[model samples]
Structures are given as structure tokens and as C-alpha cells.
Target: MKKILTLSLLFIGLHTYAQKAKLELNLQKDSTYLLSVAADMDIDQLLNGAHQLVKTTVTGTTAHKVTAIKDTLYEMEVTYKKLGMHIQMGDKEMGFSSEAGADDLMSKVIKIMINKPFIITMSKRGQIVEVKNIDSLFSGMAKEFPQVGELQLTQIMAQMKQSFGEKSIKGNLQETFVIFPKAPVSVTGMWTTLTTMDAAAISVKTLTKYTLDAITDKYYQVSGAAVITPDKVPAFKQSNGYFMRLTQATGNYTAKLKIDKTTGWVTESHITKNISATMQAKKTATGPVELSYPMKIAMKFTGSDK
Candidate 1:
């Protein structure tokens, strides 16, 4: 009887040890890292209650490099390496690719954007602090698409500036920042945050909750769930005698992040998001019509240190 009791206690202790663990982030200055991100997006348009009509799918891959310029600041560079898109409407289908001999207009545009570089500054906590070279990049694009008039160019620049401006950057920073507790977190530990973004095309407010799920010698696994709602929707830009107005928008996201225990860097992460929106549109022939669009976006990121 004594031997059996001792064995039972040992078993309970081993199980408890295996079930829970603590995790904390460890970061250092002057570190350079590279992250490869791949994204897949699907959008479907519904009109008159029809479930399927027009749909688009896009897949892209990009590399982001970050070098610590200061103890709490980093310079980030992003380069798109591959992009592919497919569009479907009834029996008609179209495709675009950033590959040789793809004559589609979107293909050409994708090619132009693929190799071009975008640089931004970010905080150590993953907030985008500043987006550099807005005017120069758009000027270069204006040269490529000369048919775009000054008014349209101005509107486009306005949109871009609104998205990358200081206020917007702070909002983005909040959304992207991973909030860790001041003390080490055990498997049962959890944290939550709320953020509002003033997006040019559509504003968003999100509430997210994160939990520490597991920990190993190499990395810590964190899981997050968020509810996203549209706070504001800008008047849609008109093009080719067609205009659109957003009516409603709502979404949710689930994310998984694997952080290196030693470096406190996110070594791998994946996020899945679903959004649904209704819009009113007016075309030259089709008067005013209401349409619903549902979109899904999935992204995966993997990182390595230099």
C-alpha cells in the first residue's frame, strides 16, 4: 500500500509538470531579422441574394527585413517576390501573374510592384512608426500610368497618406503589437487589448484577446482571437462612371504566433480573417444597386535572424 501511494503521487506530479509551463520574451538591440510572409485572399461579390457571381483570389509572397537602428526602433524593408491572381464571373475567368509573357494590365502592375522596395520604421513591439517615401513612390507610379490625371493622382495620394500617416501608423502599431504581461506568463495566462484604426478606405475597431497556450525550450506558442468592426467608411472613389458606397462591414480574425524563447522574436505566425461588407453602387447602365462582398484572408509568416 505504501509503494502504491508513492507511485500515484509521482504520477500526479509528472502530469502537472507536463501540463503547465511559463514563458517570457527576451529581446536585444542591434538585431537584424528577415521574415518571409505569404498571403492568400479570396473575395466574393453577391448581388440580389445570389451566393456566387463574381469572385477574386490573390496569392502573394513577400520578404520583410528589419534591422535595429536603435534600442527601441527598427528599420523595415519589404520586397514582394511573387504574386498571382484569378478572377471569375460566371463562365468567364481571368488570371494575372507577375511572370513572363503575362500581358494582363494587372499582371503588369504586379510586376512593377513586385521588385520595388518599401521602407518603414517600426517600434520594437511591432508597431509601424513611420512610412517613408510616399511622394516619390507615387510619382514613379504616375510616370508608369500616365493616363491617370492629376485629380485621380491626388485622390490616390490622399488615400495612401491617410493610411500611412502618423495617426494611422499608431493604430496599425496597436493592431500588430503583441502585448506581453509584465511578469512571466504561464500556460493559463491571458491578456487583451483594444485598438482603433483610421483607415482611408475603411476605419476599423478591434478587440483582441491573447493566451499563452504552450511553451517549449525553443519557442512559446501564443493564440489570439479578435472581433473587428468598421468604425467609418469613406466615400468610395468613382471610376469609369461607376461609384460605390460602403453600407456595412464586420469581421473577425484568429492568429497563432510562435515566439523564440531566447530572442523574444516571432519566429512563425499565421492568421486567418473573414470579413463581410455590403456596398451600394451605381453604374452607367445599372442605376443604383446594393451588393454584398465577403472576403477571407490567410497569411503565414516565418522569420530568421541574420
Candidate 2:
């Protein structure tokens, strides 16, 4: 009888341990990638619990021979929470915080959304939780940023233009265009729109798709567009409502992104893995491009305690 009692107690203890909830997360969004760039940054917030979330500003300034000379900044109020394997965020509430790397007008007024890593974890009663390592999370999200070599925005632009020029479009204003060349025509800029309608229009189509044409040996016949029509969009709990429409390539593709719905800003988004052929040779001749394995962009999201 004593042995039976002991067994019963052990089982009860095991059950209790299993019942303790840690943190559950379903990344509502990583970020919305409206356009490709030398780098991506954004600011966002989501409300998971009654009083939880973190708000802050971010800035990233890099100069290369190819793209813009001006620096970039992101400022935002961010919120996050966990609920039974589901992590969420919104514009109203936030529970995590990160200090500014640099304090300035451009940095304070902007919120960075892409390449920011954050951890999410829940407490016993599931009332409190956390999101950390946002900068790293985003920075480390993709494993295949550059199969050949990482390039500065300026260099990326320079290569793009050298490969294909006049075919691409230019504007001090907002617009979209395509370039047909071997490599995608290179485009470089820090694009910010002036109005909601303009943002909506820009969000729907890719601005430019060709760069280093002779080197890449590919062309961007970009088509379609998706926009989030404004309509009192709710918080993260059920804020998935938005207008999206885009052209297809007669095949299947996976889409992922991080979004700040409060301001209709798309931080970063991408079709599953952007596959590209590669050449086994590291150093290559300055002329014809060698061939190699297609690049695979591996992305993962991690969660931790607040």
C-alpha cells in the first residue's frame, strides 16, 4: 500500500509540472518589406495583455559608393505579449523595451522594424511576459543575405547601375518601374512617402527589379501590388485585416513580412526563399559570371521571457 501511495504522489507531481505554462507565441508579423534596400529598419507595437509593451526609436546610417548619402532612422512605440503558444503585439500596449543606440532627431522620430531581434516569454499566471533581442532577431533572421558577398547600399547601387542604367527609372517623387537586364537593374534609395494614398500605391508594386544585369543574367518583370486599406484597424489580437492584391508568376510562392499596422508601414516582407544560381568559384574573372547553387534565405523566430 505504501508503494502505491508513493507512485500516486509522483504522478501528481509530474502532472503539475506539465501544467505550468511558459510562453506561447505566434509571430503576428515579422515585418512588411515594401521594397528591397541595402538595409531594412522599422518601428512597431502590439498589445498582448492589459498593460504590456515597449516603445522606442532606432537609427541605422551606412554609406557606400552606390546608394544614398543620407542616414536612416526609425521611431515607434512597440508592445508585445504571449498567450498559450501565441505571441502578439499591437500599437496601443507594449511590455518590452530597448535603449536607443544613438540619440538624435532622425533617430528619435523613427521606429525601426526590420532586422531587430526580440525574445518573448510568459509568467506563471500568463499575465506578464517579455520580448528581447529584437535587433539580433531581425539581423539574424535571414542566413542568405549575400551568397556572394555583402554589399553596401552605395555599392549595391553602383553595381546595379553599371549592369543596367537608362532602362531603370528615377524620381525625386514616388513611382514604380521595371528594368530588363541579365542581372536585376540596381536601385538605391531611402524611400519615404508623402501621403496614405501614395504609400498604398507604392506598397502594391515593386519599384525596380534589375541590377548588375550582365552579371546577374536575370530580369525583374515585376507585376501586381498589395495595399492595406484603412478602416479603424484593430490591435494585434485581431488586426490582420488589410487590403492586399498582387500579380502572380503562374506558380506558387510563400510570403513573409513584419508590419506596423498602426501607421500602415511595411518593415520587411519576402517570398519564401529567394533562390538564385551560384558559381562554385570564389574569385571570378571580371567578364562572364560563373554559375553556382541558388541562394536560400533561411529565417527563424525565437521567443523568451520578458
Candidate 3:
């Protein structure tokens, strides 16, 4: 369990950071950044080959869990241009390309898990590339999968503007986002695109009417918890604004951000997410994941030369 322990510690730190992850860079203000990243991802591929491996480790497995957990290594490269982030397929990709047979595999699944690994690098304009991060990516799954919609970055940003108004992004603005399954807590990865690719919807409400926090000469923090309406609570509440947080509640989480004072750019980022959930057992299963912290992300941005 040494690996698990190491991963747990690393993830713990990262998750906490992600809970309040930084939006910093080492480059100059208003510059585009590109980061190279690799990771040790713990994934449960839909049909990880070793049926026997499936037989050994997991207990109380589900058809979907079995279907989802495919033992494998994931690989990928990233390039950030403009304000957009793009991922170029990794080595270990999970989920069936199409949805037709996805449910069929969901039947035999009991329990599924995977550990993903990757490498990360950073660079500035005409600067030498520096390696940034490399570690394990962990994930787990049980049963139920509710269909949720996929939010588009455009829609998300648009919503941000609609709710919060336009500001000159004076400081660093960094973020990571994820979605869960609709039925309860069955979402491992994105299962559906509620809106068309052209019309993808982002969680504007999550980023709405938000106030920015003061920045230290070293770093500053902005929180979504304060700006959101109570109805937006993802788990506990289910209305339109359920996910929105209360106002001025930055005390709830911490985001360790590192900034380059000379140029007001972020150098590196470490995010760790921790969550506590309360659930009541249902007749056939468990209660909804009354979640605290959700899919936390840690990202490092660097300016690009070539």
C-alpha cells in the first residue's frame, strides 16, 4: 500500500489545493501559456482485459463498474492557446467511443478502479521548457449512472459574464471543472453531452456574480462558494442555483497559489481535493452523495514560444 499511501498524501495535498487551487503563472501578465503534462492515472476502463484481475480485487462489483474499470495506463499531451485548453488523446483512454453498448457492459460490473500516471512540463516565450509534474491519477466507481448534460466552455464563460459582468481579468484566473452522473453518484467521467458540441453548456451559475478576493504580492484567491445561490448545491439541493456557494465564505477552503511578483504570473500549481458525504440507505441502494468537495483540479500554465 506504499503506492496508495503516497498517492493518498499527494492527492490529499492536491485536492486541498484544488479545493482552492491557484490561478498563477510564471510568465508575464496577459500572456498565453502552454503546459506539458503526464500523469499516473488510476482508471477503470470499461473492458479492462484481465477478467481474472477483475475477479480478484473488487468486491460488490456492478455490471457498470466492471464495464468501466479497465486496467490500463493513460497517456496524453496538452496545449493551451488563447484561453482554451485542449487535450490530445492519452495512451490509456477509457469509455466506449459510442453509447450504444455502454449499458450492456454496465451489467457485469461489480467494482472498478485504476491508477493513471502522467508527466507535466512548463515553458515561457522563447524560454527553455521545464518539467513540472508527474504522478498517479486515481479514480473509482460503483453502480448507478444518471445522464447529465455536458457544458461547453463558451457557455460557461458566457454565463460567467452574464452573472458576474465583464471585468479586465486583472489578475490570474485559473480553474478546473468536472461533472457527475445524473442518477446519483455514478458519474466517473463525462457520459453525455446534454447540449450539442456546438451548443455545449457550461455551469455559468457556478461562476456567477462572483467577487474576486485580494491578491497577495505572492498570490490572491477568488471563491465560487460565496457568490452562488443556495439552490445550486450539487448534492444536497437540486434546483437551478443548487451548486452556488454562499457569499464571502473563502474560509471554507484554501487555494495555495504561487505568483511571480515581477510579472504577476503563476509558476506552478498543486491541487488536492477532499470530500465528506452524508448518505442514507435506500431500499435497493444508498443515498445521494451529499458531497462537500467535488472534482478538484490542479493545473500549471506557462507561456509558449514555438
lDDT of each: 0.62, 0.24, 0.25
Residue 152 in candidate 3, Cα distance off native in Å: 18
**Tens digits of per-residue lDDT for model 1, 25-79:** 3444444444444445555655455655455565555555664466667676655
> Candidate 2's residue-wise lDDT over 80-124, tens digit each?
111111123355522222234533322221223223323333211
Model 1 Cα RMSD, 1 decimal = 5.4
Model 3, 1-306: lDDT tens per residue? 999999999998666444432232223322343332222212222223321111111111001001111122111222221121112234432331112234432221211111122222222211112212221211222212223223432343333333222111100112321111122111111122111000111121222112234344554433222121112222121223333222111112223334443433334433322222221122222344333222212222222122
Better of 1 and 2 by lDDT: 1
Residue 144, candidate 2: Cα error in Å is: 29
Stretches of model 3 off by over 4 angstroms after superposition: 1-31, 35-254, 276-306
TM-score of each: 0.69, 0.18, 0.23
Mark the regions of model 1 whose C-alpha exceeds 4 Å error after superposition: 1-32, 38-44, 135-139, 142-183, 239-241, 282-306
Model 1: lDDT of residue 39:
49
lDDT for model 3, on a 0 to 1 scale? 0.25
lDDT of 2 at 290: 30
lDDT score for residue 273 of model 1? 75
